[model samples]
Target: MRALIIDDSRAIRMILGKTLRGIGFEVFEAGNGCEALERLQEIGRADLALVDWNMPEMNGYDFVCSVRSKAEHADMRVMMVTTEAEITQMIKALEAGANEYIIKPFSKEAVVEKIQILGLIP
Candidate 1:
Protein backbone atom coordinates (compact mmCIF):
# COMPACT_ATOMS: atom_id res chain seq x y z
CA MET A 1 0.00 0.00 0.00
CA ARG A 2 1.02 3.60 -0.54
CA ALA A 3 0.74 6.11 2.31
CA LEU A 4 1.38 9.82 2.63
CA ILE A 5 2.44 11.44 5.86
CA ILE A 6 1.53 15.12 5.93
CA ASP A 7 2.84 17.23 8.80
CA ASP A 8 4.73 20.44 9.47
CA SER A 9 7.18 18.63 11.68
CA ARG A 10 9.89 16.58 10.03
CA ALA A 11 10.22 14.33 13.08
CA ILE A 12 6.56 13.41 13.04
CA ARG A 13 6.75 12.56 9.35
CA MET A 14 9.77 10.37 9.98
CA ILE A 15 8.10 8.55 12.81
CA LEU A 16 4.90 7.94 10.89
CA GLY A 17 6.82 7.00 7.77
CA LYS A 18 8.77 4.44 9.77
CA THR A 19 5.62 2.94 11.21
CA LEU A 20 3.87 2.73 7.85
CA ARG A 21 6.94 1.27 6.23
CA GLY A 22 7.07 -1.41 8.89
CA ILE A 23 3.50 -2.23 8.03
CA GLY A 24 4.44 -2.78 4.35
CA PHE A 25 3.43 0.59 3.01
CA GLU A 26 5.51 2.70 0.68
CA VAL A 27 5.46 6.15 2.26
CA PHE A 28 5.70 9.67 0.92
CA GLU A 29 5.73 12.90 2.91
CA ALA A 30 4.94 16.60 2.78
CA GLY A 31 5.53 19.43 5.22
CA ASN A 32 2.01 20.84 5.02
CA GLY A 33 -1.28 20.56 3.18
CA CYS A 34 -0.29 22.55 0.13
CA GLU A 35 2.87 20.60 -0.27
CA ALA A 36 0.90 17.46 0.25
CA LEU A 37 -1.41 18.40 -2.59
CA GLU A 38 1.53 19.00 -4.84
CA ARG A 39 3.02 15.70 -3.83
CA LEU A 40 -0.23 14.00 -4.59
CA GLN A 41 -0.19 15.47 -8.04
CA GLU A 42 3.27 14.13 -8.61
CA ILE A 43 2.66 10.69 -7.11
CA GLY A 44 -0.73 10.18 -8.82
CA ARG A 45 -2.53 8.84 -5.72
CA ALA A 46 -2.01 7.51 -2.24
CA ASP A 47 -4.02 4.78 -0.59
CA LEU A 48 -3.84 6.57 2.74
CA ALA A 49 -2.84 9.95 4.15
CA LEU A 50 -1.99 10.81 7.74
CA VAL A 51 -2.70 14.52 8.17
CA ASP A 52 -1.81 17.02 10.89
CA TRP A 53 -4.33 19.72 11.83
CA ASN A 54 -2.30 22.90 12.27
CA MET A 55 -0.02 23.55 9.34
CA PRO A 56 1.29 26.47 7.36
CA GLU A 57 -0.08 27.15 3.84
CA MET A 58 -3.08 24.85 4.42
CA ASN A 59 -4.42 22.94 7.40
CA GLY A 60 -5.43 19.30 7.52
CA TYR A 61 -9.17 19.97 7.65
CA ASP A 62 -9.06 21.99 4.46
CA PHE A 63 -6.90 19.32 2.90
CA VAL A 64 -9.49 16.71 3.68
CA CYS A 65 -12.18 18.85 2.11
CA SER A 66 -10.07 19.44 -0.97
CA VAL A 67 -9.33 15.77 -1.44
CA ARG A 68 -12.94 14.81 -0.92
CA SER A 69 -14.04 17.36 -3.49
CA LYS A 70 -12.07 15.64 -6.21
CA ALA A 71 -13.35 12.54 -7.96
CA GLU A 72 -9.97 10.97 -8.58
CA HIS A 73 -9.07 11.04 -4.91
CA ALA A 74 -12.46 9.85 -3.71
CA ASP A 75 -11.26 6.47 -2.53
CA MET A 76 -8.18 7.70 -0.72
CA ARG A 77 -8.45 7.32 3.03
CA VAL A 78 -7.55 10.33 5.16
CA MET A 79 -6.74 9.98 8.83
CA MET A 80 -6.20 13.08 10.93
CA VAL A 81 -3.18 12.60 13.11
CA THR A 82 -3.36 15.80 15.04
CA THR A 83 -3.06 17.46 18.43
CA GLU A 84 -6.64 18.69 18.30
CA ALA A 85 -8.48 16.72 21.01
CA GLU A 86 -11.85 18.42 21.09
CA ILE A 87 -14.94 16.45 20.14
CA THR A 88 -16.06 19.28 17.89
CA GLN A 89 -12.76 19.24 16.01
CA MET A 90 -12.98 15.51 15.57
CA ILE A 91 -16.51 15.82 14.29
CA LYS A 92 -15.48 18.57 11.93
CA ALA A 93 -12.74 16.44 10.52
CA LEU A 94 -15.08 13.51 10.06
CA GLU A 95 -17.69 15.68 8.41
CA ALA A 96 -14.98 17.12 6.18
CA GLY A 97 -14.26 13.53 5.01
CA ALA A 98 -11.65 12.12 7.35
CA ASN A 99 -11.85 8.35 7.78
CA GLU A 100 -10.32 8.45 11.25
CA TYR A 101 -8.73 10.77 13.83
CA ILE A 102 -5.84 10.13 16.19
CA ILE A 103 -4.62 12.53 18.87
CA LYS A 104 -0.99 13.48 19.17
CA PRO A 105 1.54 11.76 21.42
CA PHE A 106 0.06 8.53 20.19
CA SER A 107 1.50 5.06 20.47
CA LYS A 108 2.36 2.92 17.47
CA GLU A 109 -0.31 0.52 18.62
CA ALA A 110 -2.92 3.25 18.43
CA VAL A 111 -1.94 4.10 14.89
CA VAL A 112 -1.95 0.48 13.83
CA GLU A 113 -5.33 -0.07 15.40
CA LYS A 114 -6.79 2.88 13.54
CA ILE A 115 -5.28 1.65 10.26
CA GLN A 116 -6.81 -1.72 10.84
CA ILE A 117 -10.11 -0.09 11.65
CA LEU A 118 -9.86 1.76 8.38
CA GLY A 119 -9.42 -1.63 6.70
CA LEU A 120 -6.00 -0.67 5.40
CA ILE A 121 -4.49 -3.68 7.12
CA PRO A 122 -5.77 -7.03 8.23
Candidate 2:
Protein backbone atom coordinates (compact mmCIF):
# COMPACT_ATOMS: atom_id res chain seq x y z
CA MET A 1 0.00 0.00 0.00
CA ARG A 2 1.01 3.61 -0.51
CA ALA A 3 0.63 6.23 2.21
CA LEU A 4 1.15 9.96 2.08
CA ILE A 5 2.35 11.79 5.20
CA ILE A 6 1.56 15.51 5.15
CA ASP A 7 2.90 17.75 7.89
CA ASP A 8 4.75 21.02 8.31
CA SER A 9 7.43 19.44 10.46
CA ARG A 10 10.06 17.40 8.71
CA ALA A 11 10.84 15.42 11.84
CA ILE A 12 7.24 14.42 12.28
CA ARG A 13 6.99 13.50 8.63
CA MET A 14 10.16 11.44 8.91
CA ILE A 15 8.86 9.63 11.95
CA LEU A 16 5.52 8.81 10.39
CA GLY A 17 7.16 7.84 7.11
CA LYS A 18 9.44 5.45 8.95
CA THR A 19 6.59 3.95 10.88
CA LEU A 20 4.38 3.45 7.84
CA ARG A 21 7.19 2.09 5.74
CA GLY A 22 8.03 -0.36 8.49
CA ILE A 23 4.48 -1.62 8.26
CA GLY A 24 4.81 -2.44 4.52
CA PHE A 25 3.60 0.81 2.99
CA GLU A 26 5.42 2.78 0.34
CA VAL A 27 5.59 6.26 1.84
CA PHE A 28 5.26 9.66 0.21
CA GLU A 29 5.35 13.08 1.90
CA ALA A 30 4.38 16.72 1.58
CA GLY A 31 5.14 19.78 3.67
CA ASN A 32 1.51 20.86 3.83
CA GLY A 33 -1.90 20.40 2.31
CA CYS A 34 -1.27 22.40 -0.84
CA GLU A 35 1.82 20.43 -1.62
CA ALA A 36 -0.08 17.30 -0.85
CA LEU A 37 -2.70 18.27 -3.38
CA GLU A 38 -0.06 18.96 -5.96
CA ARG A 39 1.48 15.58 -5.23
CA LEU A 40 -1.87 13.92 -5.62
CA GLN A 41 -2.16 15.49 -9.02
CA GLU A 42 1.30 14.36 -9.91
CA ILE A 43 1.43 10.83 -8.53
CA GLY A 44 -2.26 10.17 -8.03
CA ARG A 45 -4.16 9.51 -4.80
CA ALA A 46 -2.58 7.30 -2.19
CA ASP A 47 -4.21 4.43 -0.37
CA LEU A 48 -4.05 6.49 2.77
CA ALA A 49 -3.18 10.05 3.77
CA LEU A 50 -1.76 10.84 7.21
CA VAL A 51 -2.68 14.50 7.51
CA ASP A 52 -1.81 17.05 10.17
CA TRP A 53 -4.41 19.60 11.33
CA ASN A 54 -2.38 22.83 11.46
CA MET A 55 -0.29 23.49 8.40
CA PRO A 56 0.74 26.26 6.07
CA GLU A 57 -1.23 26.83 2.82
CA MET A 58 -4.28 24.58 3.28
CA ASN A 59 -4.94 22.99 6.67
CA GLY A 60 -5.97 19.42 7.25
CA TYR A 61 -9.66 20.17 7.72
CA ASP A 62 -9.87 21.96 4.40
CA PHE A 63 -7.72 19.31 2.80
CA VAL A 64 -10.03 16.59 4.02
CA CYS A 65 -13.04 18.49 2.74
CA SER A 66 -11.43 19.07 -0.62
CA VAL A 67 -10.43 15.47 -1.03
CA ARG A 68 -13.84 14.26 0.00
CA SER A 69 -15.49 16.62 -2.45
CA LYS A 70 -13.63 15.10 -5.35
CA ALA A 71 -15.01 11.86 -6.67
CA GLU A 72 -11.61 10.52 -7.66
CA HIS A 73 -10.31 10.87 -4.13
CA ALA A 74 -13.47 9.82 -2.38
CA ASP A 75 -12.31 6.27 -1.78
CA MET A 76 -8.95 7.35 -0.35
CA ARG A 77 -8.52 6.81 3.37
CA VAL A 78 -7.59 9.91 5.36
CA MET A 79 -6.44 9.69 8.94
CA MET A 80 -5.89 12.91 10.84
CA VAL A 81 -2.63 12.72 12.72
CA THR A 82 -2.73 15.89 14.70
CA THR A 83 -2.25 17.60 18.07
CA GLU A 84 -5.84 18.79 18.19
CA ALA A 85 -7.40 16.77 21.04
CA GLU A 86 -10.70 18.54 21.54
CA ILE A 87 -13.84 16.57 20.74
CA THR A 88 -15.19 19.43 18.65
CA GLN A 89 -12.09 19.44 16.48
CA MET A 90 -12.26 15.69 16.17
CA ILE A 91 -15.89 15.87 15.13
CA LYS A 92 -15.08 18.59 12.62
CA ALA A 93 -12.41 16.45 11.08
CA LEU A 94 -14.76 13.50 10.87
CA GLU A 95 -17.46 15.68 9.38
CA ALA A 96 -14.95 16.91 6.84
CA GLY A 97 -14.37 13.25 5.87
CA ALA A 98 -11.50 11.82 7.86
CA ASN A 99 -11.62 8.05 8.16
CA GLU A 100 -9.76 7.95 11.46
CA TYR A 101 -7.94 10.15 14.02
CA ILE A 102 -4.63 9.90 15.84
CA ILE A 103 -3.28 12.43 18.29
CA LYS A 104 0.31 13.48 18.03
CA PRO A 105 3.11 12.26 20.30
CA PHE A 106 1.80 8.88 19.23
CA SER A 107 3.42 5.49 19.31
CA LYS A 108 4.07 3.56 16.09
CA GLU A 109 1.75 0.93 17.49
CA ALA A 110 -0.98 3.52 17.76
CA VAL A 111 -0.60 4.42 14.10
CA VAL A 112 -0.53 0.79 13.05
CA GLU A 113 -3.66 0.10 15.06
CA LYS A 114 -5.53 2.95 13.38
CA ILE A 115 -4.48 1.65 9.95
CA GLN A 116 -5.68 -1.78 10.95
CA ILE A 117 -8.96 -0.28 12.09
CA LEU A 118 -9.23 1.43 8.75
CA GLY A 119 -8.79 -2.10 7.37
CA LEU A 120 -5.82 -1.04 5.29
CA ILE A 121 -3.97 -3.89 6.96
CA PRO A 122 -5.23 -7.21 8.22
- Kindly give the number of clashing pairs for every candidate: 0, 0
lDDT per residue, candidate 2, 6-122, as tens digits?
A: 999999999999999898999999999999999999887799999999999999999999899899988899999999999999999998899999998899899999999999999
Candidate 2 error regions (>4 Å): none
lDDT of 1 by residue, 3-46 (tens): 99999999999999889999999999999999999999999999
TM-score of each: 0.99, 0.98
Highest lDDT among the candidates is held by which one?
1
Clashing pairs in 1: none
lDDT of each: 0.96, 0.93
Q: After superposition, how far is residue 115 of candidate 2 from its true place, in Å?
A: 0.2
Task: Give me candidate 1's TM-score against the actual structure.
Answer: 0.99
